[model samples]
Target: MTQDRPIVIGAGLAGLMTALHLAPMPVLVLARAPLGEAAASAWAQGGVAAAVGPDDDPARHLQDTLAAGDGLCDAAIAARILGAAPDTIAALLRRGVAFDRAGDGRFALGLEAAHSRHRILHAAGDGTGAEIMRALIAAVRRTPSITVLEHTEARRLLVEDGRIRGVLVAGPHGAMTLPAGRVVLASGGIGGLFAHTTNPPQAWGQGLLLAARAGAALADLEFVQFHPTALATGTDPLPLISEAVRGEGALLIDETGSRFLADSPGAELGPRDVVARGIFRHLAAGHQVFLDARQALGDRFAKRFPAIAAACRDAGLDPATQPIPVTPAAHFHMGGVAVDAVGRSSVAGLWACGETASTGLHGANRLASNSLLEAATCACWVAGDVAATPAVRLRPLAEGRLPPLPDPAVVRPILWRHVGLLRDAEGLRAALRALLPLAAGGGPASDPATLGLMLAVAALRREESRGAHARSDFPTHGAGRARRLTLNLAEAMQAAAGLADPVVLRA
Candidate 1:
């Protein structure tokens, strides 16, 4: 209710860090569920990436990140964020977040796919996100300047003359236009829009649509990375078998207990997109896919990967006894509301961070463990930006009503089939045709369908197999200048509406 304090939507790591970094200046964090429970940050298991290991440096980290991006990464952004990796780790440590340490009293780093060194800092073993979030939530509880309101959703961003004035929030009491001096959308990713994602059902890219409607440009909407090792138990959001298991020497095996990824360059430690495709293709060829950790981890698997061990146990298997059943499932979203280095959205008085903002850091694909690092660093950047902004009057926007929503049962499969892991010209167009109407009428299905529409349009335009956006039809990358796509709701929809058939990006 305070006018000067900034209003932040989503209480994930980024949102919480934003509020924490802006101490003395109060912040209100809105959440769809209690802090930590519903956040993707809480589900993260790979830990935060940093260049603090003796064998690694920030420049090497930057190089690995650029390689995983599949020719679309912004080198400057990668250099800056990777350069600050150790600082980010120190900042988290200062907040009393304990990371595992070697016997020498130095931080213990773990290895992951596509990285040159063991640079990932984990907590409580495989429960890195849970540990970090637990620490942050506790820190937030002790801070008088930060206030968290759970079970409230931001339905819309209040914009006037290209500036975000506030947001329309919906809760048990009912809808209200909340006035504020600044607004930051820390909302999570678009995985909820897919049928077989590892994300919570509520992370359906609402922030992207809210910002786009408020006139913020969206970037890289086509690049959705799929995790290669989700427990395929037919769960709504399939339980993830974290990539760290592979980094720990787990092998990808097909039927007959033979190695599947043996021919690939990186093998089991390849980029997520490559690993996912390997599993997808293995399944397509009438073979069962599995993660063989029995030999590598042996009995130590239970202690080293407690979370994943429990997940396997719940699925009627044990990593100690046999290979875990696995399949590629939709996971992190690498694109979102485009922002600058300071987390400023194109609209004034607005900022975005975490999975919701595409600040050219991830580019075409995210390197392992970089998500949490980016979330933390970007939150700090946003805090400094907010501290410099001039105060303004917090006038309430007009009364608003959220649109009726669609059941995940109806839209999830359609998204997973067309826009999920592998996309093609024909499938992408059909997806656009079906989603355009649902996207047209503003409401609950509106945001989900809009993201799907944008993804389809972007996939159809790229006409190349790169990173997470694999086009089976296009099969190969085109020879041209590599540039990121930026479009608002109007521009994206206009391009989709004009699509009578499959088309490539106009020369």
Candidate 2:
């Protein structure tokens, strides 16, 4: 079903948007499973944030994004993406995305943390990501120019002569080399690497690893955004009780029925990192924390957030009657393969967007619901750039064997114990040491194991506390500045080897 153009390595929002924009050029969209199955985009409960509300403006949105980013967001990139919000929203509508609307036909906007205005556009209650994915998948399926290969996994990027040729895929039809003139990596984030996460099990940072292994520069790999209120139901990968629930008037309380976070600067409305830390401290003190929605919200709670309601029911609780137990869980990665204003990675002819690409908009901490906004805007930008570029001849696919996959059970505990919400010099060093053996046992240095090692190394290199990456030993935030780092297998190995006694250097 394919001929030319690039192979999109995922069927998520970014991948579909990239393929749709490159229409008539023949795109092969690879999905590990059927649509809405393995993609994290479908699991998102919060809606995309944009300056779509009547009272909102792009400049205000940009400023909010920058402030939340803590001096790490690229101003030009943020401005460009924010400026395109209305058009991207319109484009989604054109593709049949059913955003919630008021009785008067105006878009219904909801507020989240750090947003000065109500600009969140939702769908069918709290299933904004699912709704957006449904619309995008339908549109992509209807596009004759794009071909979707389901139950297929991209083994590695096919790079030849410093250019991305295609990808090696393994599917029902066995291994095959799918060659294309260009390649777009819309693969999601690295949420699966942690023991507690809100992302689907398949989101193991494969896209980030693939690009990094191929010599693409990665930025801000250390900063991982942990959502503050995942339901503490002992689920292997925790279920998120979205921040939207709090926006609807839910309060964070301890077992004594005391409002714990009320005194915090933003209280129930604080930034994600601050809120996550507050919850973590409560748990550390052996106190049970819960989200109290019954008093203020009552029956309307379940109606507003059905996902949280179902989770509470599954855990033998009722949000309308009792407080729902909650904890911090890995929700979003703010870092990944580095990219520019147009979503172009360090490697030419290769592009990334969404959670897989670190565009610096999220910074050390991501403002709630800003993820969907970033994905939509960046995907649109990448698509336009790809369409404008002249078609080049497809480089012959390279012949290389992929390293075996790493065990999640081992990785989960290491990340959860050491690199979770709070980190320190000793714990991070130990994490590096522990992960090194796992990496060595996997296979050749050219494998995903090595890529995982690179991520760990990157996490170890950043010494000072900032955003989601808090180090008790180096508790103070470094001089407010952002730096980008790119590591290959050798560099990563060197850094990892030195982790036995890490040199705590600040930026």
Candidate 3:
């Protein structure tokens, strides 16, 4: 590959879509795992949210998205992304994505939590992500200008004079540097930092760590969205029972068969944070929470949600015959390397899309099913930005020592205990203390610890309860208008050392 060819990290939707959109413009894609595995994109069950329904439009979708974001959404960015949703969906169809269609030839749109319209586009029932991946992966394979490196993980981005010179990657062949002037970090979320999460274990915030170490500004590191209904069968990374099930009328019930969330606003259809907290509190109260799909879907459950049904049957339970055991698990992160309108990060020649980039569309909380839309839609903008930017002269990269492979095991417990659904200053400070040394060290836990430390500092700084970040000690919204927060490694470390105020960059 030439130095001018852009390198895309991660083989998921965002990375793949970005590469495809840049097609005819040679690009290289690196995947830690094989193309289809270890990607949270393929695990998504809820369909893509778009304003495809006849009665719906981008304005209405934007309204619901802003409401879910809980006052921190970048309205212009949200409007741009949501407004392009229809065209983005059309582009997906052009890329061979076979979204489900009704008998009348219209797109089969399903509803999900916080969505006012039936605009969730699915394929093969609940296996939306898998279907989308199947199509996109096939498209990538067929594209002549795209080069894919499976089993290759990017260890560090080689930056010089504040510009991305190359990427140091470890692959099956061994460690080598790809001297590309342009790079994109599409690596997924930070859910793996939690002990119990719905995200793939590979999503331990590697993208955030890579960008942070390279001096990129990250935003909203405190806003972690916990999905309310991860199927709890004592699994490490629990299987997700999609919120679309509840959109289809499934109820949250306890051991006594009581609708435990009935009194909560929107109940089962509430914003993800609210429902997650409700389930978290319910479980803390010594009651087992279950999603009773039996009364709602019953025999139709298997047909509508084949993937979830198979997961339940694998656990020796039937969704049709019984209530499915459920619990709150870290599902998504609304924080990452902050990007501008065109997906350009603070670092020159580096761009981010998908969950890895905090594009401000998700804000404090992400509306359900909007992740796919964001990843798909923003890929075009990122690609256009990358394509238009003049390629820089490739600098001679030094053979820097490879950082020890990251292990998230040590960081998971600290986050789950202190930084999970509910947080307090004491616990957040304790997390900072425990993570500071590991983050500063050059050991196997450094990367994950660094990410955790950043999150803990952000959480401690934000005193009020807002969106996914609920401070138990301060249970109400802060005064005045809500502002989004941004932090870098220096600021986070300074705050951790108590040498500076933790007031991060607010925008």
Scored by lDDT, the top model is 3
lDDT of 2 at 287: 98
Name the weakest run of 10 consecutive residues (lDDT summed) in model 3: 498-507
Per-residue lDDT, model 1, residue 168, is 84
- Candidate 2 lDDT over 47-111, as tens digits, reads 98889877899999998888888777778877888888889899899999999998999998988
| Model 1 spans > 4 angstroms off | 405-408, 501-507
RMSD of each: 1.6, 2.2, 1.8
Query: How much lDDT does candidate 1 score?
Result: 0.86
In order of lDDT, best first, we have: 3, 1, 2
Pairs in clash, predicted candidate 2: none
After superposing candidate 3 on the true structure, give the runs of residues whose Cα lies further than 4 Å from its correct spot. Answer: 499-507
lDDT of 1 at 164: 76
For each candidate, what is the lDDT?
0.86, 0.81, 0.92
